[model samples]
Structure formats: C-alpha cells, structure tokens
Target: MAMSRQDSRLRYRAVARLHAENIDQGFLPILGQDFLALLYQAIDESPDSALILAEEEGQVCGFIAGALDLKPVYRGLLRRWPALFLSLAPSLLIPTRLWRIIEIVRYSRKAGKGEAVESLPAAELLSVAVAPSCRGRGHAEALYIELARFFIERDQEAFKIVVGSELEHAHRFYRRMGAEPRAEIAVHGGTPSTAYVQQCADIHVSR
Candidate 1:
C-alpha cells in the first residue's frame, strides 16, 4: 500500500506501537503514555511537518515524521502548547531521565549555530519506524523515499538524521542507504549520537 496522510486516531495508535515494539530505539523512546499523545498533538499542529503512514488492512506497518524547518515546529508545538510539554517536564527531571532534560537544554543552546540558508540546504529526518513484523519488506526504505521526495519538492538538497550509537542495526541500514556520518551530539540518557547526512542525490540512488 502507498503511504498516505495519517488521521489523528491512527497517529495515536502508531505512537503506542512505536514504543511498545521497541522501534523507537532508532530515535528517542516515548517516556510515558502521554508522551505519545503530546507528540501526536505537536505533529498534528505543526504546519511545516508531516506524519505519514503506510497501512495494510487498517494496521500501521511503517511511518515517518519530519519537519522541513525545525524552527516553526518548535514554535508551534512548544510555544503554543507550553503547558502540555511542561507537564512532561517533571518526568524528565526524574533521576532515571535526568540526562534527557540536560541534553534537551544542550541542544536548545546550539540552535543558534544552525547554518544559514545561503550556507546550507538541509532538513532533519526526525524519525522512521517500522513494526518488527514489517521489517525486511522494504517498508522502511519506501518511507524514506517518500520523505526524500517531500524534501526534494521543497528544493532541499541534504538531510540530517541522528541515530543512537547503540542501535547498530539502524546505523548499518542508514549507511547502506547512503548516509554518511557528519558529526556527533550527546542526547538524552547521556548517549552519544552520530548525525548522518544524506545528500538529495544519494537519497534517490537506490530508486
């Protein structure tokens, strides 16, 4: 089945399965039940972002979500729904998730260092997840291709994807997809993450 717009209800279910299936290990894990709810809300409200789903018989097999520009995404979500995200703030402050809070602050401080539009053309590959049963069926790759097309339509030429160092499978898959390590950042859980950049041309290489 082709990737299509995700309705609110489907988005909710996908987020739960994303965490429950451990597919979120490639990105950040949902910290709590409300985390997914809040995330779907954010993605729903953002104008420059998208959450696309690939379904079969009403089941969400794979999905990808990303923002063309991160600025508006944060502004629309965190700023408008500050209270909602703030409610989750306490969770990250817990001893087990303390590092997550720190890492978020760290990244916030670095936002000012983003390259100017004239200096670079890029987008963030926020997340891509496929159910375990959906693996090896080319669903992940298809979702990526659709994502790349979205960026290409916007005339973007590069994409940055951050992957946890511990997810070797994801790292290998990304490399095979033509993404190369560009830099590293310390993320939640104090984990070191490698940021891979895939030029537009590379993203379509396998197509």
Candidate 2:
C-alpha cells in the first residue's frame, strides 16, 4: 500500500510538470503548490481517476490522466476542498497563466458546437503529454496502453479526449490511435475545439 501511494505521487508530479509546459498551458497554467494540491485531490482523492507515467533512466518522460466519471469527481473536489480552492483565490492576481483556471472551467462546461456529453458513459482523457526531448520514442503510446487497460479493467469501456483544434500534432496522434471526432466546442475566449472518443476495441496496446 505504501509503495502504491508513493507511485501515485510520482506519477502525479510527472504529469503535473508536463502539463505546466503543455502547448495548451497558455489556456491555464495552474502553477504553484495550490494547483498541485488541486491535482492531488483530483488524481488521488477521486476514486475514478487514473494516471499512467512513462519513465526513462529513472525519470518521468510522459504521462496521461483520465477519469471514469468526471462530473462526480469534480463535484466532490469542490465540496471537500472548498478551503483549498479558496486559498488559491489570491493566486489569480499573479501574472502567470493561473487566471485562466476560472476561464477554462467555464469554457469547457459549454457543450461543444456539435456534440453532447450524454452520448455515452465514457471515461475522459483529461490530459496527455510527453517531454519534448522524449518525443518519438513511443512513450506516449505506452502511457495510452496503460490507460486503456486501466479503463477496460474498470469496465469504463470507452474513453474520450477533449482538445483544441490548433494542436494538429496531438489531433493526428489521437486519430492514429483510432479516436473519432464526436463534437466541436468552444474553449477559453470562444476558440474552437473538438472532442474525440475512442473505444477499447479501437485501440490495441500490447499487454
């Protein structure tokens, strides 16, 4: 149990680091201990959340975050950690990209231009990223394989990823992984984006 707990933290830290520098981080930097605390709540406190990390030479190179049921997990986070979020309020004043935390949440809540969230009881791929230096090494695929297995074992059955349209590389990656566009949505500042869903059958990852 202790080892499992430590591994979770390690994975969280790795993903957090990658997210901070993600191409879309411009939308929501989420920097600092406050945001890290929020991540802990999301990934650790949320029973339906899953994270998988890829390592190289004992250091994290990439990771992916997913949720079996995001609405409940988010609701629980807000209810159980009001104080933590409240404490993070003042950080909004910082010039970093933290301010978008509010905007991003609002932007994502609006149903995409052509898709509805009710189409399926599918797991969500919250985020996935790999260090620039580690790209093209198959780390991303490994992480997704782990995530696929995680979802399958839990009976989540299907997974979806909401991402920006400008991220052409990532979109292509998901397409190659067998994701199909389900809807288009508006993001922070009314920018266009899309949501893609992949069934467990569509993706094949070696066990």
Pairs that collide in candidate 1 are: none
Per-residue CA lDDT of model 2 for 4-79, tens digit only, reads 7677666656666677776444444444544653664576567788766778997878778787766655675577
lDDT of 1 by residue, 15-76 (tens): 65675566645323445545555665566467666666777677777788776665565565
What would you estimate as the lDDT of candidate 1?
0.67
**Root-mean-square deviation of each candidate, in angstroms?**
4.4, 3.9
* Per-model TM-score on C-alpha atoms: 0.77, 0.76
Q: Each model's C-alpha lDDT?
A: 0.67, 0.70
